[model samples]
Target: MGLVNKTRITDNLAVIIGNQHIDVIATEDFPFDVQIRFIKTDDAQLDDGSGKKVFTPEYQMAFAAAYKGKSAFFSNTEDIKSFTKQLKEIKELFEFATLNKQTWFDTASFDGVLSQKVGSL
Candidate 1:
């Protein structure tokens, strides 16, 4: 048992850009593809004691972990689990992206990100 046995990714995570909040949803499995868009901004904020709604750190991580048009591929359980660990961390951090009103992605890019799938699991 490794990251594989310890992680499950059946949900989406949140990300923050400026004051805007976005969701990180998996559109594909192989060579992972992640896009950005508004999902829960209305309901995705903490009171912060001053009635100021704010995003969480998990959102930051997810945003940092993904960008628009990003692709992900896992060839082995270890790789999948390794990526899963990041997602799990974000989940723990919404509780824990596109580019438009309907579909948008972050222009920002990362060398290693777990967004969508490339080929097979």
Candidate 2:
């Protein structure tokens, strides 16, 4: 339903999830597509027509808050616990490249690894 694992660009202008780059267009006046992706199997920033998905401004704003350390990034204590669980389950994922948003695994493999331990997340 949502971007399960999203990376917040430092500028907060965008958030990338699994090869897709989602820009923040909080208002209708802003002229731009909200979602951009390479392909279902590649994160090279190429154009893909079928990779489209629905976008919601509210959800994007919530994800942008994650870039602000002072923001209530975690809704409650349980949110922290869920994050902690993810850390323990996959420590290697914390190390990510800053050049551009990327996923270490393909959809199926990534989902398989995380879903196996997503009891609380």
Candidate 3:
């Protein structure tokens, strides 16, 4: 998996991590990309918490591992399990993005990724 440059949906921020296409659905008044914010959050928290309305640590680890130059390709059974769990965590986090009537991705970009057949197994 690589960061494949793709189309932008809403002129919003978009970043390609591994095989996943993440787009910014909303921004805080601060003017920084939330995907970057999330990557940074993993560094800051250093621990995954089990609770309502927050990303679990294992989720953070998946992205962190990937960001640290791990290939997006999962070759082992455990790797696949970890990847699936990471996606589940991301889907849950998107609910938070939705509360603001915003999304982590724009429709077109999402469609493009969806169209490309890149998906969680």
For each candidate, the alpha-carbon lDDT, in order, equals 0.36, 0.31, 0.34
Q: Per-residue lDDT for 16-100 in model 2, tens only?
A: 3433233332223222223332223222233357774333111011111122233436789997885565333222222222122
Question: What residue runs in model 1 are displaced by over 4 Å at the alpha carbon?
Answer: 1-69, 96-121
Cα shift from native, residue 108, model 3 (Å): 28
Q: Estimate the overall C-alpha local distance difference test score of candidate 3.
A: 0.34
Give the RMSD in angstroms, all C-alphas superposed, for model 3.
19.1
Which of the two candidates, 2 or 3, achieves a greater lDDT against the reference? 3
**Better by TM-score, candidate 3 or 1:** 3
Ten-residue stretch with the least lDDT total in model 3 = 112-121
Rank candidates, lDDT, best first: 1, 3, 2
Ranking by TM-score: 3, 1, 2
Candidate 1: Cα lDDT at 119: 18
Per-model TM against the reference:
0.26, 0.24, 0.27
Per-residue lDDT for 30-120 in model 1, tens only?
2234433332222344677987656532212222334233566779999889677656644343332222222122322221223332111
Question: Model 3, range 1-121, lDDT digits (tens) per residue?
Answer: 4554442322332344323344443323212224422221222233346544333221111121123233467789997886566555445443433342213333212221111111121
